[model samples]
Target: MKVKTGTLNRVRIIGGDWRSRTLNFPNQAGLRPTPDRVRETLFNWLGQTLYGKTCLDLFAGSGALGFEALSRGAKQLVMVEQNRPVLDALKKNSEMLKAQNVEMNHADGVQFISRETRQYDVIFLDPPFRQEYLPKLLPLLPERLTPEGVVYVESEGAIDPGEGWEVWRCSRAGQVHFHLLKRTHA
Candidate 1:
């Protein structure tokens, strides 16, 4: 939780190459890193090792999901965060981990996804709660996902991903509702 060195907060890598490794970030509003328990469950649903998978982390606050994917063998990862300070913190964490496959973007996550043409094996979506970001963004995700690709969504409440998306797996931890989804049609 709180790593009392200055104003930094820390979170540990749940599993993978960096298991037990701690990452630090500033106290920024709306920046909740995925909890260790939730991440462990999500990764278990997706598999322990990503191995050569390309990934994307939208609204990548604190770089938790993306960095975890990297630790598990994700070959390439692109993380988009709107907040410059938060993005800088992500870069700092990336450097601390000596990660080479990460590409950080200081841009609006929604706009980046809407304009993105590349497809990925996995995508992490944990936008700020109560913003109704899912409705505007989910429609844009199917196209960005490679065939068989899965999307991991974390939200304040259960979400209806509409038609064509199948709920592969889902679970809840207190106020956090997470789901692993895949395209059901096409």
Candidate 2:
């Protein structure tokens, strides 16, 4: 419940016993966990039929997205985070929630994508701003996503999806924008 290092930013676990309960995260190290309003909007976009779906959370800072997916009834979740301290914090959070279906991986996001052979129903990507990892990340997703699956990318502004995807939705919330893409055929 207490995330060390900075001020505690309270978050609620969506659609679970702890739903609406306040959970805290350390705000240091530029760790701005996604805003709750955005998270609620994202899940609403996903709908209530998310139960039993497989989810991949890349750039899993604070593990909020993946945890929310699971809390909303996602059957399985794989969170890939490269930073060591963040990964440790994520593991602790997962344990605190007693989420047995979650798998935590510490590795560069790109490497994790390349090595993962399984497909997921939903993939959440929130790479660091201006990193332009989208171009490099998009090509590798076809093999990792189920047919008709969606990839959600959150960035500073609009993402053009220049390669390997057909944009399904592009919307903005304040300073952040999100692109939801479906894989293109080979």
Candidate 3:
């Protein structure tokens, strides 16, 4: 769980059978998973209704967020990661958990989202902070997300949902911000 000097340590998986399990993270140039406290808060907001919901974890770094959803009770989980090493680690973790419902995709998160036709109930987007990916990512969400799906986006507190997205809730812990947005049904 030793992170590089001045960097953060391994984030705990938060809940379920994998609770307290710490996954290793490589010293890649730009990689920061959501902190455990923020994740716990997010899941608490989600409550006990995640069962049977399909989930998509974009920018699935350590696959921690997606795994937590699966552990809780997600019906199917799709992890999209572009980094080879991260994808490898995600695969190993999926195997370790015997996650047959977890599907791993090695590609750009945006590209996958654009090509994805199947919709998901929950989508986790934890891209690098300050990258300003939400604006671009938000518009594409309508296509991949279910009509009433919930989106959990963790950023450095810069996301401003103008008018198209109906933000259900927003909260911040430390420097991290969590958003719960829902797409209007058409």
Candidate 4:
């Protein structure tokens, strides 16, 4: 379950401006980047273009999802990661890509979400699989989205949208269950 630290691993940008580009990340436990097949499916569900959208990548491990959004024309991307090494890699990749629209934050995902007042067009939630973050986080997302916004959640297994949220799309790849969720009434 844990990859050796200090090993070099990289993920490729599957489409958009940075297509075929690679970004390196440290091999840290639970630091899984969204896999290529899963990301391709998720982006397809989101539509290929993210033009002018504001996105938040909470629990951003490798910055894969956020960077992909930026590459696809998102207006802005905010990535929050609490792990120091992972955060460093994210910063390095942001600079490496000349990502002017990306913002990196070092903070706990739940704490950051608690204090954030601005809503996002898309929010990527890919927390550590061992933690029960979904139960607490799902309830907080509806208020954090724009009226027509969506939230992409990746977990170890299938998860319900809970209460006011509805599943826009859902799929599985290996051990990951990923879903695009939207507020039912919004």
Return the TM-score for each candidate structure.
0.95, 0.88, 0.89, 0.97
Q: Best to worst by TM-score, what's the order?
A: 4, 1, 3, 2
Tens digit of lDDT per residue, candidate 1, span 51-123? 9999999899988899999999999999999988788889999999999989999899889997899999999
Model 3 TM-score relative to the real fold: 0.89
Per residue, candidate 3 scores C-alpha lDDT tens digits across 1-186 of 654543334667778767777676555666877777778888988984478899999999977789899888899999999988778778877877787688999999888898899999999999877777877788888777777788998888746766577778888888888888887654
Candidate order (lDDT): 4, 1, 3, 2
Model 1 segments more than 4 A misplaced: 1-6
Instruction: Put down candidate 4 lDDT per residue, 49-102, tens digits, no spaces.
Output: 899999999999988899999999999999999999989999999888999888
Model 4: lowest-lDDT 10 consecutive positions: 1-10
Error of 3 at 167 (Å): 1.7
Worst 10 residues of 3 by lDDT: 1-10
- lDDT string for model 2 (1-186, tens) is 454663555566666544764445556454667777778777777885478899999898877788888888899999998877677778878878888788989899998998889999999999888777888888898888899799988998887786668888777888888777887777
Quality of model 4 by C-alpha lDDT: 0.92
User: Which candidate, 2 or 4, has the higher TM-score?
Assistant: 4
Each prediction's total of clashing residue pairs, residues at least 3 apart in sequence or on different chains, is 0, 0, 0, 0
Q: Against the true structure, whose lDDT is highest?
A: 4
How far residue 84's Cα lies from its native spot in candidate 1, in Å, is 0.8
Better of 2 and 4 by lDDT: 4
Candidate 1: pairs in clash: none
Question: Cα RMSD (Å) per model?
Answer: 2.6, 3.3, 3.1, 1.2
Q: Assess candidate 4 and give its TM-score to the true structure.
A: 0.97
